[model samples]
Target chain A: MSDFIEKFSSISLNDIKNVPESDFPELTAEEKALASQAVTYSNRIEDADSISNLNDSLRNKTFIVGNKPSKADLLVFEKVFKVASKWSSVEDVSKHRHIIRWVDLIQNTLVNVPESEKLKVSLDIEVPREIKE
Target chain B: MVVTLTVAAKAPLVPYGSLIATEFVNRSNGDGKIDLQVVDQKSVDSADANSASKLTTSDGKEIKGEADVLKELGKLFPDVLQEVSKSQDLIDTAQNNLSIKNFKELATHLEKLDAHLNFRSFMLFHKCTVADIAVWGVLRANALMGSIIKNEVYVNVSRWYNFLAADERFDAAIQNFTKSLAELKKSEKLSKGKKESHKA
Candidate 1:
């Protein structure tokens, strides 16, 4: 029973989704897209252009690359927070209102994230409480 | 100037308290990066130990105290706590204890540290902290300690002190202070010899 738990525990949701469709029929194409998008954006988290793109995508969404919280959001937030945490200037943060809202939601929602694991973004850009069309 | 250097590089933070990477640290000690122009307010009485060292910040703010100087320098870094190494509270006590000129109190400080050294290898931890550096720096600058520390009065302190003195990190700062003092003494002797020749 312990051996079964250890084997399954090591296999995260990300690993299951990444295997070939034949190996795992439960893996949906949309979930694959979400995880892939997270990897792509996380790789370029340093580029300002990628930050703006992330801003646009996160306008109506709560998380970065998924409908709800998952490893996808965790992946991007870990990288993006390191970059966005440095955006202290009014002009810098205000340029991407969506990012501020998303960063705020992600940071406030995540409970177990240790300070050493990821940096917390600290800026006041007057972001609206709710997203408006 | 970027403050809070590894006490590892410089043997002791000079008498002014902490290493400020000042231009005044002679050519050999000046690392170019941390060097800043320090206007040393030449106190009238050179023997006056109570006079506080002062630093004029880039913003024209006056900062005093060795601990405060280190923290102010730490603020220059993105993460102050990460940059400034631990046991500042320990260093603070060392700074105050060493600054006491009275022989009775000075011995007490030495005795306390000697006792503490009995329990741990270093001042506060298994490894060297700024407390060790700060205390060592203060002792290094005091002429009386040079003679007193030579004898095994505080055996634990002498052992720990010798260990720190051997480290190459503290060598640069130690050499800087020692060299400057030697130069000053040499120049004084030369001037005295000239005066005697003129009289003869």
Candidate 2:
């Protein structure tokens, strides 16, 4: 699995809360910086031109990370594809054919191979160890 | 056609569903041309399961992803293409701007949005387009930044926001989501209390 997929798998829904502070996993300084950059990249998605530019840039690539759809593709897709329909038109999609192809691949595979099915098959969530007195 | 849109009440992307529902309602004008029903999935997991954009068409075609649904909608209403497409840019900008963790950066975005709203009631033309719905829905769905909106941080955006808040369609779209979220939180607290009592 890719680094993001591993890290994201470690995080449970409990880690996400309305209130800021929570028992999230410890991250290295580099990971923290990457998180910040992700936020910036997420923000940039609001601009159609910026997204179009990104799509154009990624036209040659099969996915954002590796040939297969990784958590990286999912993350970016959540931000871009989630809101693309509400804002983007046919023209925009035609302009960014690569993005559409990438989005379709993820959406299709994700539906066919549901995450719940994966969790059912694997014991990914760790149990808490007993505390030492 | 009957379209069912399911979403988590508090999901960050909730606004997308709400905005689309708002547009459908406004354009339909009780003509029954489109029947869009917004369903709130209380649990976060259930919401995330089909979070993209879960739209079941009249013919039982389950379509996921925000882009896919909008494309379908655009095909039905060709005039909405330009407005919806333009609104995507504004919505994207708002999502990024709203994610600004630093106050300084947030203020800069607020100023820009305020200026955009200056002397304008809606984001695009004189009428309420998908752009207005998208921007308004984003800010409204986000309670943290929603404070800025409620506090009237940006004069023009606030004014425009208030105008939409009073709209029947806008209010109608949010009424159920707000109520469902509150109920979900209440049940969560109850369940937490039960767990604590069991431990005690």
Report the TM-score of the second chain of model 2 against its true counterpart: 0.69
What are the TM-scores, per candidate, against the unseen true structure? Answer: 0.43, 0.46
Clashing residue pairs for model 2: A43-B96, A46-B92, A46-B93, A87-B88
Task: Indicate which candidate wins on TM-score.
Answer: 2
Q: What is the TM-score of model 1 when looking only at chain B?
A: 0.63
lDDT of 1 by residue, B46-112 (tens): 3543333434454567555556655444444312112245656665776678756678978878766
Per lDDT, the best of the predicted structures is 2
Where model 1 places Cα greater than 4 Å from the true spot, the runs are A1-133, B1-17, B20-32, B36-52, B74-86, B181-200
Clashes of each: 4, 4
Model 1, TM vs. native: 0.43
Question: Model 2 off-target regions past 4 Å?
Answer: A1-133, B16-53, B59-82, B99-102, B182-200
Q: Encode model 2's per-residue lDDT on A88-115: one tens digit a residue.
A: 4444444554455455444433222344
Clashes of 2: 4
lDDT of the candidates, in the order given: 0.50, 0.51
lDDT of 1 by residue, A30-132 (tens): 8668667766977887887788888766643444433334455555666676677677665666566556555554454432344464334433224322212
